[model samples]
Target: MPMDERTRAEVERAEAALVEHYPRLVRLAYLVLPPSMGRHRKVLTAHGLVQRALPWRAPRRPAGALPAQRGADPGAGYDLVRQRTVELALAYEERQRPAVLLPTVPFVWGLRLFPRAGGADELALDQALSAVPAAVRAALGLWQLEGLDADAARAVLVRAGVADPEAAQRAAGQVDRRTAGTAALLNSGEFDPCTVQARPTDLLRRRQRVRATAVLAAVLVAGTVAVAALPGGPPATGPVPTAAQQALDPARLLRTPHEQWAETSRVDFTAWPPRGRQAGDRQLLARALRVWAAPPPGTRIVAAADTSTRPPAAPPRLLYAGLIDNVMVVVLHDGERLVRYAEPEGATPTLHFARVDAADLTSAGGLVIGRGNGWLRYLIAPWVSDVAVRDLLAPEAPPHGLHLAPDGVTDRIPLPPADGVPCGHWPATQFRSSPRIDDRRSFLVTDLGDLAPVHLTYLPSPGAGGPGEATGTPALHSWARTACTLRSLRGTGVRAVNNWAYAQQDLPEGGGTATWVCNRADTWRGPGRAVVQFLPPATGPADPGKTAGRARGTAACSPFGRHVLGDVHWQAKSGKWYLLAAGSSEVAGIDVTGGVRAGAAAATLAVPAGPQAPVRVAGRLGDGRSLLALRP
Candidate 1:
């Protein structure tokens, strides 16, 4: 059928308007929905909803009729469309249940139409908004983003099914409180409205066709399945294991080695370049044996070394070295059993042992010399104790190597010093080292008795750019002292503790002040411990405007592990002025100096106030490993 000129013009005008406002509508929809639904899904749903609400399909009036001939308010048409779209989206979501529901509006537009900005702050706002319920989010969007007043926002929320006006007002207040900073950022030109690009008409039509086909196909398949399942049959089986899962299965790998394992474990024999083909062959065989052993769950063999690479003067000993996950795993086959040792990358290694069986021995081919060797060598290595294995491996060093005594022997094996520092009173149980960063700093954490970790940070010294300097001895000693103090504090029944270096100031004669911060026991039912520091102003005329008795320092605490602290303010709750800090987990508070301290009792510290009016404060965690905090 041929369309009349008026009707055709109206259709074109509606499409042009939709195209112009498509991106804005999509952004609004995205903000309306929870972020858990993901950006892509939200954009698509929003586009669809908007398209469906277009007035092109409405019954046409007689020729020469006015815009209001059908009783439509031309000025308020957009609002009506938006409201209808939101309602449709909500209804679709309700009916879809487990499935992804289509939003009320519709338009064939690409997601690139909506570009995101605002960086980390924007991301934080999005995450915060996601935590809010959909209704609350809608109210916020309407009130803040849409610049609607309280009554207007309430009306929108009421239309969206929020029955209580008080609830709507409360939601608006919460949004205002939570997004105050974000709103400032948004208004500060951090985010510009995304420009809409014109998409090809053919591409848009093709997308619509594809979407329609997908919907029709889905409906047909659903109908067919419903008819076929009219009579119940046997229960469905669980999903089949994927190829990756099958390859990773320890049982399957033990029974029959997967072909993928060969590639994963292959090592270049040429890298060693043995003196003779015999040595090279031996090295190849050792590499093959190490590969055959395979890594435990969540680890992989990155590098391997063995006796084949040993010097001719060295005694005959079968050894294999591999990187398990990021940790180093070294295996040695003794006459009795196979000794397995593992160390986190750059950390002290730990030792274990496993029994060898005849079948296991044969699995390694000619590599087996001891009765308990062979494939059984790889299978039986059990982790012994949570201690460093480096000392056990290096017998010729200062500390004698750990000797494997007979069963029931009561000899204590000597272990090497961790990071050149004697363990002393603090024995290392487990150790972890993070990857070296910028070739300058690396962190090593040693799990001491009772899981108290002594964190060591290795950094380049003055005049050195790489990680070759060894000038951190003083820092290490300082950390050890702090760790000891924290250990004692823990002994006093303190829970949920962490320690960190808060402030450092260079002093005269190359000396410096290093302040440490730690969370005390949570006996007060508050969020966490509160530590406030005060430092006297620097002497001299460096800043002539500097006032006297002005104390400057940091205050910080954490209820759990390392968490980014949010806003801090003097909040008055129940007639008490509390120094409160908010984070993602919970808000922590400590009684301010001169605040009401009666009702409840817990250990309290007086924040130093030395005649400084309008006292300024800041909070800090710690730099690298200077401050240590324990995780439960």
Candidate 2:
């Protein structure tokens, strides 16, 4: 057909845009296209879409189209090509199979080409974006690739024929809330199609194909003869299976009603509300279930000790399904264990299973959804009304309010230091539901390298009833100097760690008062571990307290046992040495015999002594039972 002047002019403008901004235009299309389509096809299809965006004949612009974007070709050509590329990419996503509408030049037969593998952030964003709608994905591309805000991005979507631009923009906003620094990742060469790495496909298999052809033909003939010789041919088998099945359907997943959390007597994972932005997304849920049930070969599977990696027999209860830390995560509970299925963008997926056989209200309150860069985020229970983070090592500092999304996931908080490192601030997540400021039920939990965090509590005295939640400033300050000791309990399947401040006494020579606290780590498996530490009076932040004694496989600091006696040699600022011994409140008197002979009617006894003094400390309880000091 003969080209009119206007059509020729439009084509010439588009040609100029392509010539000047070919790489940027192709990258925009590449990001807009679905990542599920192999990178090879995405690279080829992205190039093809950009080329076809330039119409042979003049194209009609849609209504309400915005002017050309800033810092681009400014001739209206770049805008025309960009919108057309996004439209074609969206259309391609809706197609059944991969196809490039126009022939992509420079295509090779045997080699597969793909963009360079990106870092963890890029991979995570890719995986998360794959679960969103095509229009949402397109809006993200415009925002990142074209540097357009919500309004400008929506205008582009509307011009590209999106039915509901407002809804797309809102959905994109939700994604933006969870993901950070996406533009930088999207702009990196990780998504640049023009610059790609290429490798031959199945070289070994291709090389051996001809050599095995004759052998395969002979085997096929023998198998056909053998099948024919069987009695009544091959026995009847079950009907052929189809792609659709009830088990894999997302709608079939067992979901507890939102109200069940408050109405039910149970307070375990079964009562957790169905939370997360993508919870209702059937496609994402289906993919999650499929990957969990039959994870592809090479899929990474991690399981806690004694935890089974078997897939659930039935569709388990959905706890959460959404994008967290740039990755798509789906948490499920099968009444026995909690399973976490994580799919990082542009990378292999992973399955983590942790034993939660009998989770209690405290242990089931929250779970680590994502962790990275020395920070941890939690998917908290719906019943939780308030969230705050406190540094256990700096108990005097006020707790910082933590933000939570509508889905009940808390913002990332600083992680505690690892073992063998100098004592640093240990951050603990504080959760409470009651309205009262001094609610004794408000609990504190710290991550210990497990799916469920370890609960922290304090027992001020034996007469103070059972160990209560650590809420008051006194309890916080007591645990502050000893929280670093919990690092040794990491990955130990510990259910709770309690600090018992049993005795406080004045030091010798009027130095100052000191407190003796015992910490106990109760594991799910039976045995308990205890560490007795002597904390000097508030001096400075540099003091993290000293571990006086430790006992394993004992119930020393527990509610049932409730008796601990420890001694430590201290050096006062006057350069004088003294022996300090303390016992649980139940003790009537403590006697420091041997090297330093001294007796105190109270549970604490301090007497002057020498360094490395061989001291024998013993205590007599109210019931007249003798208690011996624990050895470190």
Candidate 3:
């Protein structure tokens, strides 16, 4: 049935706010549920319920605050939505497959966990809600449902003769009595989802074991229902406990015999090859275990995927790669691990092997896609940077310049052609041809390629926008003669264009502009500050004009990787440069830094954490020290 104008308008308002907050809310719901619970199932089901119960329409333009819910608790709106949703769901449950039951209203709450709604606390929320009783549930559903104004609802109640405040209060006490009637079902105002449900389950053992198991079969049921009530807060995954406040000082680990060989491939210390799951309780693929820890140098080496070198075979599985930058992982999966590897032994490397890839090669690591695809096809030579190097060579120019762009980093600014600059022109060279050093880190070895003083000019930030939006390109142009190399550093932003590292930023009220980077020496400045090489540009829409971007007071700079990044969001608040680095593990940090010696300090932010997040993810739970989740 078409919703009435009033309901439609209310839904539209709620929906707008909902859509804005959905991503975080859904993620939070899932976190509370745990992957094993199939949070996906609950999410799909809940969203479906919302669609049917509260269809929305275009809202009439309203100047300000929504119709107030006088005398109604803040949760009243959602409770109404929940009640309506449940009615629809229960009717359909007869025909639907058995699935996890979820709360219809998702007003994510976790006071302490603002800006985030995931990780461990979600689990607690889940446990707490599962303990809600029938009466409490009814009260919760009726009161928190969406779109009902308190006065209107109260008027309806008055008409229904449910009684005035005094009478209603008397009736509420009976449900309250039942709510905490059982020891297992304590009506503690404070919630503890996990334990709450567990107590009920325990009670069922003496009464109805079979019934208990049948009722809460799906994990999502416990997860969603329990967590749906609380405000989503600090990411539970939080950061890894600070690593003893000390650097690995790699020098300590017994130096492997093949240091040169290891460096050749960029030995990644955290090379997790895609998670290998062996739920059968059997040994995980032996080859996987073997590769988990680097081989003891002297052990007999086998093939890349060969499983024979190692013994027991287990089910093969995909592994998550945990690799450090500038480290090549020399994986010899002891014959057994190879069970999962596909082998076409006779195959040969095509003259032009496939291209464009990423594998945790840097600190600000994520997927860095080089924007220009057509540029490569159009170039006369099938190469990245058109530079030439002989025997041992160093990375000079963009592609070879360990940058985040399609090419590593682009040394766009030529430090001005010097009197004795080699070739005196930045020549075109391919990354493959460069001589590498410390884990793909190599110097611009003299023999690598011919010196070409390539003067590639570019307009600065706010490239093509009109008026005040006209943030120009890097005005400070440099002439490159000798080996122009780039060493990838860290920075912030989302996709290549959305990234701040390679873009420009304008000051508020159209003050001045600052480009994303400033490269000095071979090393690139990082986390979106300092001088760094530019990645080669591929054709795309010209950057938004500084004026266009700055209108909202944010300058388009670097695009974020997985986390969202934008000038409007990050820039407006702090005129200073910020780096949205994969600060640590899954943890994304907002920080600022200067030149090489510059130390980075975390910026106050509100991001959630996960099981695999980094250290310093959240400022120490209560103390200055971070809190790590340990299974009790």
Candidate 4:
């Protein structure tokens, strides 16, 4: 009854392969597994599936096995283990429960484990993977993580029991095509289950379960008496339940002293002192807490995407509580997020939540306290000495003074035009701090439909050096053509928007110099949007310029991604057309394909072409990094 020599060798080989590539196999399983299964379950299930995949009998060597990764030897045993692991994972997803009745090995009790949280890009990729079918997810992981080609991915899927490998591959390709560079995100820590962080599960629930049996008999005897005394048909609705009574107590709310801003090491929201006419109103504070814990029916709550609305676990620090324009307003900072609650004269209360974690000097400058009746008022920081409103489009004009009451609330200003709509005048709040203030710098900010306004800055052409203040004439002239473009970023939780003029080229026929600018809108989270525009020589009124290319949720124009490449079709005054292309300083060479085949050793390229010739472009940096043009 003992195994033969061949079977024993195969078992040993499979086990060796699994042990050698344990992290890779677990990551593969984690990516393919259904996300609906919580992170804790998925982590244990991935390990369990891989552990059981060791073959007792020799597996048939499949034709055209996928190429190995990270200098792997492409052994038959590794291929067998990978195929079996994928098969089991897909089977686990298809069935409501595990495929086998075995308990998860190395399971933990009363503890939940999850992979390290990643930035916005990783969060976005995880969400995208969750939307597709399990087979498609497997195909994507194989293609990205295992470095498999399309045909290889299809073959792997087919070997893993996919009914329609072609369909699954196509579905995965659709996602890949929609989002460029998403494949690289698979390598992030977000999908690696081997390296995880652990947190205790609901200990309160565990205690309740332990005591339930002892209290069962007493509850049964008391239930009869309580039921006989009850007289209601249906119990009236009450406030939402809270775990800790201290959270709901108004007196327990934390407060920072007015002088704390000067002594604090980190000059952020933590340093802001509580101020308002009703700062000491216990009844009003209690009502705000109650509503925040559990809002009545039909309450409107506007929170940023992916932000949680759960009430704070402990009493939050009070930032502001005031009556602004006949509306009762309360703002709280719970160390990570900023919560603003507003109740109009007779309207239902509305709550706003925005993540302010790791806030800096620029972000801590102001918070939008009240917005109603086509106006918005800001709760400026304590150190801001003077406030002014400037028309970003007309930088040559003088700034108008904005009145700030003793309470630090500025006079209401008109709301900017709706998102995506171009307007002639764009008003930005200009804050001037006293020179004695630490890290003092004058900057401009404008509301973006969130609690915090986004900082605006201008980076002059590469020769002019680093980013400059928006107040300067040169920076103002640079921002003139780019002001209107900021409208498109409305409603997005944008942290800052920087405008950089990366390249300038003189026209071939003495048509003067043209500029190429990259405008990047970075969010509080990591993901950002980038746009490249072509601006011709200015003559009369300011032109908005023509947009050449755009990319969303990319780091093309930020510090992390300091490369921008784009192309445009321009016709000189001589009535001759040319395909002009340029990139940031990093791009060493440029290549054009499709309608024309050409290459440039420098960052700039000019090719004679028809008015509407189809073309594509890509570039390579001096450091051996390759980048595609923003167009495609």
Candidate 5:
């Protein structure tokens, strides 16, 4: 999240004079050393170095280190927590025996402790960050954490210390020269004490990393084992099939080769691009997505696109794309990289489409995923716009059967019909975060206690139109949303109603008041934003085009009901469910047809911010498993 003025002031006050946030930096760096070797001393020593390096007041006696103090708080600015951690790590490396031997575990642990970091599950994510590549990291970090526009973040990074590539090369040469001087005598065989080294640490330090890794691994394993050993393997009430018509998989509809994959990422904000214009920049972004959509396993990219250019130039750099809304848009960057995307347009011209808000685009870590009820329209209009833009914009009409791809692509994988019972009792997992590499692309996500239902509605679109302009709402979308009555937690696993309200509220580092809510079972899949509530009932749809049977009543959601859900969960096509506790927060919500009533639906109860005011847990609302946390 971006730092507000007050917070920024505190961080600036703390960092401007020196480098990082505070003592936490020292603690983080301490983990890189051999644990048995006076960790406290090492941490304190790191603190001493920075203390001497940047004192409350620069000391007259230059060489001596001062005792570190912690009262000062930079009111705010930048990633205060992160800045503090980086300063500590970098400085600690400068003084430690094995400067390059950064144990990844300590870094991850430090991130988890303060301000919390995301995408820490693998090595590439961790490597993508650093204090040196300041520009790239700053621009991309905002892109990843706050989901800010890439161009904007790039500008901010440039304003900081980063400069263009010509300047960068000059700096690199100067660094080499300074290091090669006779005083810098690694080559002289004087056995320099401060040389950068390999990743592996001495046996003692290695042992420490080993210890932490083993502990974390074992803890996770034991937790899994414990769940498996839980009483009676989660009660036997299986999911009863709902007879809603299902959409044909997109693969079945398309005859050509179709493939997609999600890739993780990293950046270096300090690395600026070359001065002047660059090559094929228009294709840079479009191709970037394609690269990640299909990458070799165990490998990761350095930027959203190119990896060859380290320390890319200039902030506020444009992430170019070639196609958008049926028009070929090529971003121009006199000193920065640009982006362009295309869409279809006809006689009416693509100009009729509204420009996407700046907030909609992300450049740092890549596209963040979100979740909400929405429609998958099946439209069938004559081709009107530019074909290139049309294809990119999804202007073609949706064909019969469930699908998201072109006509005739087959994607059918099946489970018991709506007439049959599911293999388990829990509500099927619903998509939580929208479309991101880490989470499922669910059209409807709701918790009915232990059992959650995640339904994917295939909204038909007019053969020719843009995104948000699909044809018809799918059945699943309708089934997930039904009624506005402040009813009691209906099915099972529900305890009581606590508090509820709908507001355009902004929450803590993660959550916020919901943005959209889909109430009608018939509007499940569509072109607009959606906020789905419930899911298809056991009997399924009474009619031909829906999942919920006997659908009736105004659709609504209750903040007053007690919900028992973890942070994230999902149900695959196999009918098997997967759950993650707030692991992935950003996702594209399911598409709903149109606008939801603004603010909270008229309610009798008070709804404060989630996490406070007795917020409901993220869980299965359809299976009666809603959970609410009581703060201590």
Candidate 6:
């Protein structure tokens, strides 16, 4: 049973590539697999699937190829391997749990009860997918994760035994509905596997152990030969630990609070930016108070306080300790600030603090602490101890600061300039007019000694120019009026604009309205330059005569249409002008100006145009709703 030289080489190559792409494969598996499987199992399953599907043979290269092209291309090969692996895993799932007819009432109710408490959109999506039928889930995974089109996705489903085209289309539609607001989140690279920590090596070891265990069990059951008995049989099962025993265990201390007062134990404060050697416990207490008070106004503070005098060997330094609302708040504060941390149960504790507030305190009674000028009194649980506090903080450096880019009409914290200037202060403003061309908008300069400007945009009053309006221009003009009107549509329940193009408006009547507007004024010129049209809901019959034309590039008129026409732009890559478009569901780019009716999906337009020529492209959907974009 020895392996041949070729097979050994192939296995080595496959292992190397898999090791490099392990994280990505795990993330892909997390998305495609059902949430009920949990993180560890999902990672293990993904590793197994990827291992089985890898093309272990050395890649074939054309003769006379350069040295650079001689070896196997892991990146190119990975995509195919990953796709095949997901398809196979899904197929296996389908076979394991074949489609079954369930009672309609209970099935609908079960969908409602599915868990939906995941903090991130990606996690929420995984939970949502659990409620979806297996066939529908497969369809969605193929489209969302694999970037397959409806037709391609349908073909895959059909091959998997979902023979009916309508059923496949219905599954695709269900995916579109369930993942409406989360499509971008699912496609983003910021996935966080909360509890799963298995690596490729771990998976390999687990597989080997499982095989060994199976062989041992089979041998024992068969009793083919009289085997020498070991010293002892399987270990005896012990009774469950009592409440007292559980309370004493350090691991269970955080979850279960003890009523009996135990001697307070002190441990070394290990958080970085170590507290000054001379700093006393009182000073540490004050520092913790400051952090609690510094959070932006309206932030609720939850904290615990401990005044026990019992000191154990190497007691935790009072780096930062305070009581905000009575729950004892203690952290291994660096000399300057509380160490940033996070701790998920069962994983190694980290130094990052969770965003805790008054609502989080479980204690009923309040506590009193003397502050500089007055006594600080707040309600917090007394059960939280120093040991629990240590468990709460994650032991890691702070994540990168989040910088929210400014939307047209909101005050935003400006990011620091490249010169390492600090953001100073931005005075609150009541109302500010949109920026007009040639007119300077007032800026709030930070006081951090840096001249960083935080721009504030407020809702325009009755007569104020629209958001981003050009200055020194007459307000009652053609395109300007249209812009103003579009802005005014916000009053009609158009809460926000998606990609600055599509507006979802709720009608005064029952059904909602989806409008596509051309926000770009400089390039829009033809007869129907600023296209604003209503899109049909996805529940009704398709509208006739809604085809790709000069006025409408790609529009959907079907009930399932939820298309948005992204801004059209030309990119020169490899000496060809590539038109790019993006939207919900599916987007197709059509070369209307070139008189070509054929359409290509949203990522990149199929037609190649000259750089000098103006490209007029339309984004269309399967149901026939279209929006024309002219980039001159």
Estimate TM-scores for all models.
Answer: 0.35, 0.58, 0.21, 0.63, 0.21, 0.27
Rank list by lDDT:
4, 2, 1, 6, 3, 5
Candidate 6 residue lDDT tens string, 1-632: 11332243444545565677666555555566554343334444555665555654544445895433224655544544554555655653422421221111111111112112232344445444655555666666566666778877676566546657567557556656645455566555434332333223223334545766997898788674435555478864655754333322323312111222121221111211122222234443443333332332212222111111111112222332333222333443221122222122332222222111111111111111111121122111232221101000111211122221111111122222211122121111111212221122321111111111111112122123233322112211112222222221111111111112233333222334432333321111111112332332433222211111112222222112234344332333245553333343354444345533346544234344454545456667566767554332
Candidate 3: worst-modelled 10 consecutive residues by lDDT: 348-357
Model 3 misplaced stretches (Cα beyond 4 Å): 1-40, 47-145, 149-357, 363-632
- How well does candidate 4 match the true structure in TM-score terms? 0.63
Q: How many pairs in model 6 have backbone atoms within 3 A of each other, for residues 3 or more apart or on separate chains, i.e. clashes?
A: 46
After superposition, candidate 1 runs with Cα above 4 Å error: 1-20, 59-75, 92-118, 184-632
Query: Which candidate tops lDDT?
Result: 4
lDDT of 1: 0.34
> In model 2, what is the error at residue 485, expressed in angstroms?
2.1
Model 5 ranges with Cα > 4 A deviation: 1-136, 139-161, 165-455, 458-632
Candidate 1 lDDT over 182-253, as tens digits, reads: 446444322332333332333433454586699789878789676678457777675475433343232331
Q: What's the CA error at residue 44 for candidate 3, in Å?
A: 5.9
Q: Candidate 3 at 46: error in angstroms?
A: 3.6
- Candidate 1 is scored at a TM of 0.35
Displacement of the residue 384 alpha carbon in candidate 2, Å: 0.6
Q: Which portions of model 2 show Cα errors greater than 4 Å? A: 1-252, 280-297, 304-310, 420-422, 434-441, 591-602
Clashes of each: 23, 2, 119, 0, 173, 46
| lDDT of candidate 5 at residue 439, scale 0 to 100 | 40
lDDT for 345 in candidate 4 is: 75
| Candidate 4, lDDT over the whole model | 0.79
lDDT of each residue in 1-632, candidate 4, tens digit only = 12343344455666788999999999999999877565777899899888877755644445685532333343756776898888888986634345372677867998878899776557556656766889989998898888888887888898877999898888888777655576677877888899999987656545555666657877797887867875865874644544445777888889999987776668788889999999999888888887777666335566654466666778899999989888899999888889998888777787888878888766888999988755799998887878888887787888889998889999987777642235777888889865656556788889877898888888877656655667778677777778887766665678888888888877667778888899988888778899999888876435677888999888787777788898998898889998889899888999999998899998888888777899988998999988888883
